[model samples]
Target: MKDPIATMKSFNRQFQLGKPEIEAVEWAWPQEQGETMFHIINVYTKAAQFPRLTAESGYRLQRVGGMILGMVN
Candidate 1:
């Protein structure tokens, strides 16, 4: 199985969109001092094999609520 982290990196390196599109890959993690924390996951790239690559990777985290919410390539 392939690694999700490595795959994400590779996908990012291979895919090339406009500057605005490329900027969407950034993620923001919340930092709450006393309350709770939140993280926003946003990925933008053009990889047709992304789904298949992730599927074969046995990514259990995806089922546990970690979502690939926004994808624009």
Candidate 2:
């Protein structure tokens, strides 16, 4: 993704439409070892929705060479 933030924002907007399961979407780009990291946080209302969200997000990110570090509560 040439513009990771923009890409994610677009994805978030599309994903959140009519989806009460998701509360919020946040992201951060922190520099680590001279490389920028893309971190995404999806706040969801239902625990059951987490896996699907995570999987979809991971899949999208992976297409741009991004990886999920892990999930945090």
How many backbone clashes can be found in candidate 2? 0
In model 2, what are the clashing residue pairs, if there are any? none
Residue-wise lDDT of candidate 2 within 1-73, one digit each (tens)? 3565565455556554324222213312332111222334322222223344556554443333222223222
| 1-73: candidate 1 lDDT, tens digit per residue | 1344444445445543333332333221112111111122222222212333344222332321133342422
Model 1, runs deviating above 4 Å? 17-23, 28-42, 45-73
Candidate 2 lowest-lDDT run of ten: 27-36
- C-alpha lDDT values of all predictions: 0.30, 0.35
What number of clashing residue pairs does each candidate have, in the order they appear? 0, 0
lDDT of 1: 0.30
